[model samples]
Every structure is written in C-alpha cells, then in structure tokens.
Target: PVAAASIGQVYKAVLRADASPTGERMTVAVKCQRPNILETVTLDLLTIRGVVDFFCTVPGEGNKKLRQDAQGLLAVLDLAATRFLEELDYLQEAANGARFEREMNAVPVMRDVVKVPSVLLDYSSRYVITQEWVEGVKLTDLEGDPKYANEEGAALRADVVRKLLNAYMVQFLETGFLHADPHPGNFLIQPDGRLCIMDYGMMTEILPDQRLAFVEYMAHLTAGQYSKTLDDLVTLGFVSEELAKDPAKREVVGPVLAQTLSALYAEGGGLDKKVEILDQQAQSRIGEIGDKLEELSKEYPITLPPYFILILRAFGTLEGLGLSTNSDFAILEECFPYIARRLLSDDSPRMRSALRTFIYGGGDRLNVAKVEDLTRGFGSFTNAMEAERKVAVTGEGSLAVRSSATPSGQLDAATKELLELMFAPEGNYVQELIIEEAVRAVDSLSRDALVQVWQRLPGAPPGAL
Candidate 1:
C-alpha cells in the first residue's frame, strides 16, 4: 500500500480473519508509524519550544539587559521542552485516544459530523492507530471543480461548514471535548454528503464554565458589541485583564474586533439571503482577518486556551475548505444562526443566564426602539465612511463632482497609526517611536510615495478592515 501521510502511512486492509465476528469483509485503515518517528517528534518539539521562546522573549526594546533576560527565558523554555519530550510516550498518546473516544461518545453532535473509527485496540499498539476505513473523496479534491463551484456546490459546502461548526460548538460548549485537528485532509465528504472526520490523536477539552464564557464572547462579537466583546474575551481568558485595560491596546483591538464582527454579521446576512456576492466577500475578508489575527497573537502575547485554539483552527480549516469548494458559500452565516439558536435554547443554562443579564440591563425596555434603530442605522455610518474613504483614496468622484475638486482626506490618528502598523515590515518595529516616526515620514513623502505606502499596507477596506 502507498503511504498516505508523512508521520504515519495509511493502508487499506481487510480485517484479520480471526477478528471478524460474522465472517464479513470489511476494509480498515491501518496507520503505521513512519521511520524514526520518535526522532521526528523530538525535533518538532524542539522547534516548537524554540518558537515559543522567541515569541515570549525577543527584545522589543534596546537593552543588553533585556537580551540577557531573554537568554534566561530561553533556558527555562529548554528545560520545559526537555521535560515535555521526556513525557512524550506512546502510552500518553494511547491515553489521549481513549479520552477522545470517550468524549466523542458523550457528545450528540459528534454522532452527526464526526466518525470515530472503530478501533482494533487488541491489534493496535502505541504509535499505530488501526480504525475502520471510510470511503470518501477528500474535501480538497473538490476545489476548483466546476461541478462543486455552482449553487448546489455552495449549498453543500455551506451545509458541511455548518455541521462542522456545530460539532465544534457542541464539543467546546456542551461537552468541552473537541477535535484539535480539522484540516481538510482530515475530513472526507461522502457521496451522501455526510462529513467523516478522522484522526483523534490530537484533542482538547474545556471546562463547562470556560465553554460558557466562550459562547458569551462569540455572541458579543457577532452582535458588534466591541467593548463587551473585549470584556468577554478577558472574562473568557482569551485576553489578559492587563491587555484589556491598556488604553492603546484596547483602542487597537476594539476596532479590529468590530470589523471582525461586521464581517461575521455580513456573512450571516449573506447566508440568510443566499447572496453569493456578500458571502464570497465575507469569506475573503475573514481570511484576511485571520492573517491579521495571527500577527496580533504575536504582538499581544495572548495565550489562547488549548480548547479555543482547537476550535479556531478547525473553523479556519473548514472556512478554507468551503472556499475551495464554493467561493461564495457563507459558512459563518450558516453557522451563526445555528450557534445562536443553540445558545438561546432553553436547554442551555448559560444562554438563559445571558438572557437574564440582557433583560435586567434594560434590553427588554428598549427592545422595540433598539430594533428600529438597528434596522434603520445598522451599517449606515460605517458604510458611508467607507465609501468616502474609498473616494478620497482612489480620487474617484461620483456624478455631481467637479473635476478639480479635491476630497479632503480625513482619517482618525488612531486609524492612521493602525494602518502604519499594518504596513510596517514584519519584525521591523524597533520601538514605539519608530512606528510613529515611520508613519510621519511616509506622510511627509510625495503623494505617489504615500500611495505606494498605502498600497503596501496589509489590511482590508474600512468596512472589512
């Protein structure tokens, strides 16, 4: 059999005659350890530790003292790495697989979206996983295929994403057990359209209280409550209280959070209306935001809880797969309503608590008035500002403009600073003053140079930025 993976080679095989209960033929996926897998694992662990040390230390300010401190930090990290590697026994992995199986069995959504392969435990040893074989096409194989890029394809992809998200939500919120790996290759789209998830070697669990906090954070984010979203993030342990309290950090994270919320909400609208245009744009914007968030993770040093990281990576992978199958599929939109419904259901105590909080906070008092305002004013301000910015930046005038008229370029200083930060070359921020100086230098340059600087900046439009 041909090798199906790098770390482990998968083979299609029949169940051993002695193991077959009914003398029925059954295909199984046999995963064998790659040559020198222990060595590879050690190297990978070392690499990861090195990266963590670099991010946790590397000087942001000039001082040999800081460098010496960083060296000490790296020394600690090396010790931690040594301990971690020492404990990387196959027995640990087997224990993890057992835990994953137990968790999956406890979750209802897992029964629908995930396939925990039937393990031949007696035949399987550590470093090898033998499970029932699943016959299906790889999600990646459907990418760019005309058959999967039309309306039908969009619907199918959206449905898959919806199921995937729901599964993760359930695992993260309800059971607190989640699949840590959800890459496209790990998923199989059956002819019946059922999604088969494979691999359980990597999984994480969240506490029930943590899961509730996560739900609240996501709800605030989707509703465009920027401050509340940040607050929820801190409460949920996604961001530290110190970071949230920092005015500059808050200013930076707030708008970015709002933009993310807008994009998510817009995607929901697209899914509701079945608007391909909005869906595609939302997905693209989300991809861009994901990239920015990765950068932000480095600067802010926010240590994401393992369970949250699993869900984030899963959702991101699902989004990418959805895009590949149908660029117009509004995955977030399809998933949001499901998540909202789940969150608001009578069964969830967490949702009930949030509802009570809202009602007690005068939400019920202003429900009607707030509804009207949202219906009338939602997106209007942001959209108008975005339109104006586009016109100013592109020098394009709509019908009632004189050719010689110059639109006054107005942008908040904070916004300008953010743009400058986004445009700065990676790892080039020597100091806080350097960023301001760079922005000022660019501002003083020729119009063409300024335009070049703006073009080089990494961000979306004001609406999606």
Candidate 2:
C-alpha cells in the first residue's frame, strides 16, 4: 500500500483471523481519511471561491488568465468542488469503484486484462475503505523488473498499456464518465498480466453532447482540418466567443493550438521509446502555448469547460506515466476501434448522427435556405453601400435620421447615464447587455470624460476588454 492525497492515505494491513469477512485471515490495504480532514475540508469548500482565487495567484502562466475569465474560473471552482465533495464521501468512492469495474468488465477487450481490487464490504465504513491488497509492480519500476524485461514481457506491457488507454477512452468517448484522476500511483501491473487500476474517489461525469463534441474534436484533427478543429474547440468551451470572433486573437491562438496538437501526436513522444523525445519536446511547446494563452487571456475572454479540462488532465497524466515505461503507446490508434464501433452500431443513434456530421460531412449538407440567406445579406450590404454613397454625395441626413427613433441628444444622454449607472457599485442594473454596450462605447470611442470616470471606477464587466 502506497499513496497520499489531500483527503486520505493508504496503508498495508492484514485482516485479523476472527475479523475476516471470508472467515479466513488475509492481506488488505486500508484507505483512511486524514484525521479531522472532513471538517477542515468542508470549511475550505465553504471558501472555495477564495481557493479558486488562490490558485490564480499560484505562480503559474494561467493565473492572470484564470482571474480574467470569470466563467472559466467558475468552471474550475465547480470542478474542484465536485472533486473535493466526492473524495470526502468514502461510500460514494466505493460505489464508483464497483461501477468502474463493471464498465471495464462489460467490454470484451478489457474484461480479462483490466482489474480492480475487491472491496471487503464488512470492513469498509464512512471514513475507511478496506480492500484486498494487490501485489503488482509499479509502472516506472517495471523496466528493472527481471520478469518483465524480456521481449515477451515488453509485448505484455504494451498490451496492458493499450487496454488501459482503450478502457479510459471508452469511458470518455462512449460513456461520458471517467476516473478523473489516474496518476501513476493509482495503477499497477499484476504478476499474471492484468492491469490493476485503484482509487475511485474522484469521478467526472460529462454530458452526452460534450462527449460527442470531444469525438468531433478528435475527428477534425484526424481529418487535418485544424481551423475546423479550432472552431469545434470553441463550441466545446476551450475557446470563448470573444476569442473566436476576434481575428487578431484567433491568429494568436490557432497556430499555437495546431502546433501543440501536432507536436503531441508527432512521431517521437507517445507511449514508446519516443516518450523521452516527446517529454522534452512538448514541455517547451506546451509552456509556450500556455504563456500565449495566459497573456491573451487578459485581453480576450478565453474559457475551457471543466469536463474538457478534466479529460485533458487524464490524458496528460497517462502520457506522463506512459513516458516512464519507455514504450510507444498508440493511444490514438486504440481510440479508433471504439469510435468506429459506435459509428457502425444501430443501437447508438447519437453516434450515427455524429458520424454523418463529423465523419461523412452529412449534417453540413448544402441547404438552399442558408444560401439564400447569405445571398440576401450580400444584396443588403451592396444596397446599403450604394445608398451610403448616394447620401454622402447628396449631403442627406434624412435617411440616417429615419433609422433612429431617439434623437441624438437624448441617445447621448441616455448612454452617458447608462455608463454612469454601470460603474456605480450599488446601481444594480439587470440588463447585462447595457453595461457591455456602454463599456464598449466608452472604452473604444474615446469619450474622454467617460473614460476618466471609468478609470476612476474599480470594476467592469467580465468581457469588457
């Protein structure tokens, strides 16, 4: 038994002869919460917003970015809240363990290779989990294990890694739920070639749409449509409306993301000998993207949904752990089987629809109505430009006046009033749009007096910039 986390620690133990649930003494691992952790954790959860703010100040590239993107910050806090609450419930964790085991065992490819320790139901409680002590080798230390150093053992290790990745991919691509934390400590290699996955305290469940969006994201990348991939990313909550709609900022983001994705999957750093190569190469690449994203985050409202971030965390953790094994793990290849399986099945209507839209490009089938609308917009723009030229040449104010119901003086006064109301902390305006438009006018139009007032004010809307 070996591990420690924010909530608990694991220890090697043996059941007493008379206390055994099986009526025989046996080795077990006791997972118990830290002393008085619950009350403190609950207290901390109470101040979780401050916890989010604290993370924003934790000397990282995304600190300023996190502070600026309020929605993204909220998403982070939400994920943290869910994780902490789930981890605090030992009973919920026990249930998650059983569910995970069933999910794995239900899939034929994973049934034999994937394993979870049996819970000693009689010994478990609200603060403790007693499970069979598993004897398995650590992944990093597997290189030195005499029994697994040979070619045969290497194949077995590779197979195990494949199954592990596929199992998790299924959890992500098909099931919409996954083990949120899968760091090296939670995994082990059994003597008889089984992959033992432990710990179930943190489970993340995503919506079906999010799962389909994830698949769409992958399909775009596979199809070599980086721009479309980035577009899909915006829809999936990685890029925000502000960022996607801004050409200059999108230029800053697009290449960084494309390069990062390309480099991550590029030949040298998967789950093989190239793990070292990728580990070295990707560090700087990812850091560069993080820096750019963080800096841009101040000016553009960028956000990553919590589920997407959690999925990314799982993959990153697996990638880091796979690096230690010195084997090229084909994580992408493993995903193909299941994704293909889902697409071909009649039972999965969602997958079939997603396949048509994503894989076969069917959902985007040409529409006469959309074309007509585009044509109409073009005609309107053309007519408006000609009308503008005529008005400019004729020196006419009547046409422009007809477009506005409010007089210029009244509109200006109203805008000024709105701007003032927005900056006043106790103003309490419910129209979010008013503050946004007023701030945009004041900030962009260089209304010097309004600018002075805004400068004097302490706060603005989240995406005012």
The local distance difference test score of model 2 is 0.62
Each model's RMSD to truth, in Å? 21.4, 25.0
Quote each prediction's TM-score: 0.60, 0.59
lDDT for 173 (candidate 1): 67
Q: Which stretches of candidate 2 lie over 4 Å from their true place?
A: 1-27, 39-66, 69-74, 143-156, 241-260, 266-300, 326-334, 345-350, 353-465
- Model 1, 1-465: lDDT tens digits are 644765667788887566764367667877777678778878887787676566556555655445554554565556545534433443444556566666666654344335555666665776666677776666666545577766766665655555566566566667776776777677776544445667666666677777777667655554555677788878776687887888866766776566655655445333444345435544775556555556665556555543355567666666665555455555545355444444333235556555434323324232433233322221222232234334434645321211222357965433443455445655322233345556766766766665666666787243321
| Shift of residue 292 alpha carbon in model 2, Å | 12
Q: How accurate locally, in lDDT, is each candidate? A: 0.56, 0.62
Model 2 Cα lDDT, one tens digit per residue, 1-465: 477777788998888889987778889999998889888877877786776666655666656555555546767777777787788888888888878777766764455556778777677788998888888776656655697777666755554454467668777866666987887667777655456788888888878877777776765564445666777887787777767888877777776676656555644455444455446544776556667777886665545667666777887776655554544444444354445444333234544444444433444343345323323332332232233333334545221111212345553322343355446565432233245456766766676666667666787544343
Return the clash pairs for model 1, or none: 268-333
